[model samples]
Target chain A: MLDAFLGWTGVVFVFIGVFFLFLGALGILRLPDLLNRLQAGTKSTTLGVVATSIGVGLIVRGWILFAAALAVFLLMTNPISSHAIARASYRAGVKLYPGTHPDKCEERKWKLPEDGEEK
Target chain B: MRNDTPILVKKITALSLITILMVGFFWAFTEMPKGSSVNVNNRVSRLYILKNVKAATKSLNSGNFFAKGMKPLRSDVPYSPITFGKSANLEDGAANVVTSIVVDYRGFDTLGEVTVLFLAATGVAMLFFGKRKKNIIKAQASLIMSVGTRIAYAVILLFGIYIFVHGHLTPGGGFPGGAVIASGVLGLFLGNDHYESNHLGLKLFESLSGMAFVIIGLTGLFSVNSFLANFLPTGVIGDLYSAGFIALIYIAIGMKVGAELSAVVDSMIVDTEEEWS
Candidate 1:
């Protein structure tokens, strides 16, 4: 009985994780900006992977420790990578939408260069 | 002007060529003997199968009567799986036949492969050497990245070590394990600019390991009367300490590859900086 319940729970988690992964892909394809797309891709996919791994661990024997390890690894790497991409894009002068209010990162205020002074 | 005719011709030619190659490969695959007859009724074991195979070869060779329409047979080198698969443990005290073959039977080939990697690394390092300024200040990674990278680096390094160490017993060997180790170094490079790796130490390790590999082979040649022979005592068939020379050679390869790859990455990173500067 306990095994069956655990299996069902694992199945549920796997389905939910797959759904989130689908949403992440959709967000990546549908989002307006690079940052928005990157955000969706990283956050949702990381969580989805963690959930799926944990679910697999529950369903399969001898994989629980590995699943936990992979989850920890994902947690360690994802945020940092996302931060890097965002920072790099910002430094490269990828503009955000003007409709968004109070752009704190726009404090630098990139001005149009004089015609001859372009690097 | 004449673009349409040429384009059409090129497409048709490419399509036909690809189709021909695919069909030829498919036909060859289909013509191959598909069944694993050995496992059908558990009748044929090691010695019997080998004997039968030999017999079959002899019979095929004996049939010299050629027909007018038949294609010429290219009977070349005979393959014997029983030699390695059955007597691997007996020969080298190694459980894995593939490992035995790589480390024992064809170690010279592996050495050549390592030398190729080393030469490639040297070429990359040379390309990056001329433009490098003494003690160039590198940009530091952000706080979040630094912390995360530190954690990831440790874990990856540990995993790489595990892979290299347990290579003899497991499916993974030195090449992949060393690549994993290099990835850890890459992580460190990403984490912080102040990641002070000892360039001297890396180079020294690479050179020393490569030298040790050759020296070990030479020593085997002198002592055991064969080049790259299994001279050391093989401890156990399946244990960690078993396959003495194979294990040592793999360790040496792992260190060399890891150091060389890390050096390559370092040089490449420097090369990129030169491009921007």
Candidate 2:
């Protein structure tokens, strides 16, 4: 009974994870500009991978250790990778979306050289 | 002649090459036995699995050849049953059969592979030889990236070590382990703009490890009658101390490969100043 319950729960988690991953891909396609797309892509994918791996760990009795370790590694690395991309893009002078407001990077004086004068 | 080749000629050449490749592939495919009907009882793998290669070799040497289409009976050559953790002093006692085959049965091939990798590394290093500048990234790496890379590098290095050390017992081996270590070095390069790996140290380590491999093989040739033979006593299977010289060979390969790859990464990342004379 417990095994059946765990299996069903795992299946539900896997379904949710897949759904989130699909949504993340869709967001990546539809989102405006680089930063916005990265936000949608990285955050949702991180959650999706974590949940999917955990679900898989639950399903496979012997794989829990490796699965959990993978989840932790992904959780730590994904955000940092996204942050690096965002920083690189900003420094490289990729323009933000026209409709977007609130220039926090400009306010903080994080802008590098003038536009077109790439270092 | 090379640059001004006609499009029609190029297309024809590509088509002919593909046709030849496909023909060879199909010919090999026809020779392969299909489906579950294929019998493995008479195959050499049976002796490997049972750890009875010595018996089979002895039988073959003593002029006990099997008749046409007839499998060798147990009465002809006895096969000893090998239980994990109980069997000792077997000819090749690696728990991972692939490791046993690669390191013990066809070690010369592995040496050739290592030499190929060395030549490739040497080529890369030679390409970026002489006065060089750092290939600077436009944007400085973020704080998180730098710190995270340091932590991740350590973890990756440890994991690579674990992989090569357990090559005799697990699916991973020297090549993959070295790749993992090189990836860590790549991360280091990305995270730090001024990060310079010690060139002399890497070269020395690489050469030393390569020499170690050749020396071990020479030792085997001197002690035993064959090159790269299992000279040491292979302990019980599944133990860390088992598999004769497989673990030692893997360690040497792992170090050599890691150093070579790291040097390659260093050469590629550091920009060479062009001398357009």
> What TM-score quantifies how close candidate 1 is to the native fold?
0.73
- lDDT tens digits by residue: candidate 2, B1-277: 3879998999999999999999999999999988777775677677676666777778667765354564753346554567888888888879998899898888999999999999999999877887776454555566788899988899899999999999999998999999999999999999975688999999999999999999999999999988999999999988999999999999999999999999999999888886553
Question: Model 1: per-residue lDDT, tens digit, A24-115?
Answer: 99999998888889999999999899899989988985898999899988988888899898877866679775665776656667543333
> Which of the numbered candidates is closest to the native, going by highest lDDT?
2
Task: Please give the interface root mean square deviation for model 2, in Å.
Answer: 4.8
lDDT tens readout by residue for model 2, A1-119:
98888888888888889988998999999999999999989999999989999898888868989989999889888888888888888777799999878888888877654433434
Per residue, candidate 1 scores C-alpha lDDT tens digits across B115-206 of 99999999998777754544444334568877887888889878887777777777777888889989988988877755667777999999
The whole-model lDDT of each prediction reads: 0.76, 0.87
Index of the highest-DockQ prediction: 2
Name the runs in model 2 displaced over 4 angstroms: A1-9, A92-95, A106-109, A113-119, B1-38, B62-66, B70-75, B78-88, B132-137, B273-277
Alpha-carbon interface RMSD for all candidates, in angstroms: 10.1, 4.8
lDDT of 1 at A44: 95
Error of 1 at B183 (Å): 2.5
The runs of at least 3 residues in candidate 1 whose Cα sits more than 4 Å from the true structure, single-residue gaps closed, are: A107-119, B1-89, B93-95, B134-140, B232-237, B271-277
What local lDDT score does residue B13 receive in model 1, on the 0 to 100 scale? 85
- lDDT, residue A91, model 1: 64
